[model samples]
Target: MIHRPRRLRTTPAMRALVREGALTPANLIYPMFVREGISEPTPISAMPGQYQHTLESLADAAREAVEAGVGGLMLFGIPAHTDPTGSQATSPDGILNRGLRVLREAVGDRAVIIADLCLDEFTSHGHCGVLDSEGRVDNDATLPIYAEMAVQQAKAGAHMLGLSGMMDGQVAACRAALDAAGHTDVAILSYAAKYASGFYGPFREAVDSQLKGDRRAYQMDPANRAEAMIEVELDLAEGADVVMVKPASHYLDVVADVSAQIAAPVAAYQVSGEYSMLEAAAANGWIQRERLIAESLTSIHRAGARMIATYWAVEAARMLRNSL
Candidate 1:
């Protein structure tokens, strides 16, 4: 009886004081999609309230996110052109690189501007890497492109590269490329434990994916948790500044595991499908929108994510500020 745990729960202020982890706007990183050919901001039907922005709108959004106290911004580009090798990914003027440039110029060190260093959106085949003659994703062939893409992204003013390709040796190759190009300061956030989950459906729509099959060959299997540690350790050793686990809501265990063992910070991605589900549920009045949004992000943080990349970054930050 002397323990009296209920004492802390008696008042909202008391519970706030005893909170184990704090979820703030600074911990949220907004993931934005920018389309090369878009003339204006286009709403993504699959992921409501999110847009495939044009360069001008992207710049405006970057300013808005920075003003909202969002800690970082991650850009994914939908190129106007795609080839077998995903040539746009490494091109300086490609959509993602251009978006990075716009973000850096607009935000100006006010927030970290990150580019998605994967070729899926730029590949005609919708795979993360280039394919061999047999059409399977050739891992070795992809590393060099990733390296080249890293340098280009760095040159385009990306503060960080989100290496989400799940390719072997991607981090090492990119690190070497960036260093050689005098971009040693560009950090790499590797998607070390990205799972091939069913939750990526809405993302395919957001990017207008050309994928027919899945990326199971490279992405980690959702059934395996211990395998994540192996990937996490390898990416860290290969020069990943931060390690991430994707689909944050479903993989809180992996997030906790990585955060617990790794000496470095951990990032978790609250991907499009996860965002869609909550939005749909909230719209249907099945769940309380604002409270659930805050709770979902808080749960991810409580599970040990040092940072969370989410679609609701700006809105969530504003809600948090208003609550205070």
Candidate 2:
């Protein structure tokens, strides 16, 4: 009886005080979709509550997140056109860049603005990079475009560029480009251990992705754990201010591994499919939605993620605040 551990679980107050990972609004980053040539917000079919926002609506939402004390806002763009090279990804007037501008003007410096630096949303072929004549993604050819895109995103007022593209040397290329363009102050958030996961299906719908083939060529294989360390190490060497592991809940081991070795802050994404599954279960009355959300986020943090990119950021932030 003297050794009973039930004392901690007996009271909500005891549980709160004993929690190892305290998830605050400061630890959450809200990911959003912004579309060009849309007057009204377009609801994403796969993500019931999320929308491909118009400039006005995107700004409004950024302000809302800022008000909620969320740490950052990540912007993904959908353009009116697509091309073989994903040209708009580097354009100053690109939807992502424009959304960055709108967010800056809307929220000022209240929250960090992180741009999704990838081509899948803009390319006609739906791949993350331009295809060679043989139709394989040309990795070296993609670097220059990514470099230019980084400079443009920096000019657009992104506090940090989320390099989601899995191209080799991308972190170096983007860091060089940002510094050369006098954006030395802007940071890089490298998706160092991104897996080619089935969980991205809902994200494809959210961004209006036109991709016909899988990104397995560049993205890490889901089965590989050791390779994540290699990727994370390379990214850190190449000047990534922060490093990330994607599909966080499924890859907490990778998150924990990366965190254990690096001095840089670690980030993990609870991607679209993860969000959808939780939403579906809640709608079916299978689980308490808010409790699960808080629990899942806390688990990711406990697994060593210093930051978490999630669709439920705002609501979760509010939840954490209320618990105190």
Residue-level lDDT tens digits of model 2 in 1-324? 689788888888899889777778999999998999988999987887899999999989888888888999999999999999999998898888999999989987889999999888999999988899999999999999999999999899999999998999999999999999999999999999999999988988888888887888899999999999999999999999999999899999999999998889999999999999999999999999988998899889999999999999988888877778
Q: Which ranges in model 2 have alpha carbons more than 4 Å from their true place?
A: none
**How many Å off is the CA of 138 in candidate 2?**
0.5
What lDDT tens digits, residue by residue, belong to model 1 across residues 138-243? 9999999999999999999999999999999999999999999999899999999999999999999889899958999889889999999999999999999999
How good is model 2 by TM-score? 0.98
Worst 10 residues of 2 by lDDT: 315-324
Q: Which residue pairs clash in candidate 2?
A: 126-211
Per model, how many backbone clashes are there? Answer: 0, 1
lDDT at residue 107 of model 2 (Cα atoms): 87
- In Å, residue 16's CA in model 1 sits off its true spot by 1.7
